[model samples]
Target: MYALGLDTTSSALTLGISNFDQINRYQTWDLGRDISIYLHQYLEAFLAPLSWSELEWLVVAQGPGSFTGTRIGVVTARTLAQQLHIPLYGISTLTAQAYAYACSLSKVNEGELIAVEYPGQRGSVYGSLFTWDASNQTLSTYKPLQYIDLKGWQQLLSTEEIHHHLSPDTVEPKGICQAMIALAHQQWQAGQQPTWQDILPYYGSLAASPPSC
Candidate 1:
């Protein structure tokens, strides 16, 4: 089965094409322009040589990242999934990052992985901690997403046994694609198909920065 994944939920724009066993990815960061334009160009270029009709699944990073970037990626993935009549899987961007971190840590050592993604707010970030099981190739105890202040981040860093870290600033599309493909396959086997209307981005509730005491 062939799956296509898009992650334009941050400063980076990632496009991934995977065939159950292998993944090919293209990512560019620091696209200081309209995200939609960059996403369209990348998708078009990436899909130019292949027939979109052959894709079996479409996966997207449902966001807690850039508001505009999340919208651009979700809308595009939704439209393409709907048009192609393929299953759509929405994976949390933070979770994807955590999974990537877990996979990396599983290779070199044994410990917990923490994934953090900047929420594009004044002084807030979104983070989740996860434990990895390399023998089974699975992740467990994924902590709920939390909105953390800079102080909270420092606390997490000092207190948590964070062996590996994955952030948008350091995450690669190749790893993201692999995680998405694996999750997509699991969803497909379980008969879970996501719809365009059901896949929405995660925008944290923080109207304004908390005032300092």
Candidate 2:
């Protein structure tokens, strides 16, 4: 099965294509412009060497990232999924990042994993904690934090037995895409392929402590 994953959660645009267990291609661009414009251009360029008809699924990093970026990615994924009549799966960006980190630290003896993403205007970050199970190739969410205090990093550390860290700084598109593809394949095998509407991005609770520019 062929799966395509897209992540436009940050200033960078990341795209990945995988066939079953192998990643065929992956790309990341730091396009310092509107996401929609850059995304379209990037997709067009990337898709030129491949045939969309060969794709069986589309995976997207459902937000908790940039609000505008999330919208652009979801909208694009929805449109493409509809046009292609393929299954669409939404993976939490934070979750994917955590998974990526876990894979990188597969040799580590013990520790908790944390994934974080900038929430743009929210003033706080959206993060999630995960316990890595290397043998099962699973990273289970220990706790989900929609808004976290940046200054309380030490406090956050105390809340969990995190001997290791996997923040956004360490995550890469290749890892995110691989996780998305693995998830999509698992869902497909389980006959749980989701519809387009169900693949929409998730923006965490909208409550606010007004953002500081």
Candidate 3:
């Protein structure tokens, strides 16, 4: 089965294409402000030689990253998945990061929670807690993705904090597409049959809602 994964949650534009057994191609570009403007051009160029009809699954990073970028990425993924009649899987941006970090570790315990964090607007930061599942070599949601102030973030690291069990780790946007693809494959193996309508952006705020096309 062929699959494509996209991640535009950060300043970087990440793309990954894979067959069930191997990753065909993956790339990351520092697009900064031009992500939405050039996403299609880059995607088209990357997919120029690929058979669209053979693409069976579409995976995307539903985010706690750039609001506009996340919207564009999710909307694009939804539209394409609907048009192609392929299963669409939405992976959490933070969870993808945590998975990447865990994959880097030589050893990870089954219940070890990893806090993936990134800066947010003002003095806040986007944080999500995910537990490393040793058996599957993937991550499970430990705490729902959230936006917390710097104080809350610091407190989260305190011994008495609710998420104190979670060990903090950082993940850069570079090479994240591969991790997203891996998580998508894991979800597919687990029999997750998601539709285009099931894809949504997670902006890590109470007032934020999933983008509607």
The model with the greatest lDDT is 3
Residue 70 of model 3: what lDDT?
88
Residues 58-149, candidate 3, lDDT per residue (tens digit)? 98988777888888999999999999999998877667677777787756677776666777888998776677777768667766677789
Give the true-structure RMSD of model 3: 3.5
Q: What ranking emerges by TM-score with the best candidate at the front?
A: 3, 2, 1
Candidate 2 lDDT over 156-196, as tens digits, reads 76777775666666766677767766666666887987878
Count backbone overlaps in model 3: 0
Against the hidden reference, what TM-scores do the models get?
A: 0.80, 0.83, 0.86
Q: Measured by TM-score, how close is model 3 to the native structure?
A: 0.86
Q: Going through the candidates in order, what is the number of backbone clashes in each?
A: 0, 0, 0
**Which pairs in model 1 have colliding backbones?**
none
Worst 10 residues of 3 by lDDT: 160-169
Please provide, for model 1 over 1-213, each residue's C-alpha lDDT reduced to its tens digit, 9 standing for 90 to 100: 678888877667777787756456555555745676677777878876778887888888877777888778888899998898887888876676666666665363444565455554778777666666777666655556667776787687778766766667565756775676666667788798876667766666543221110
Residue 103 Cα positional deviation in candidate 2, in Å, after optimal superposition: 0.9
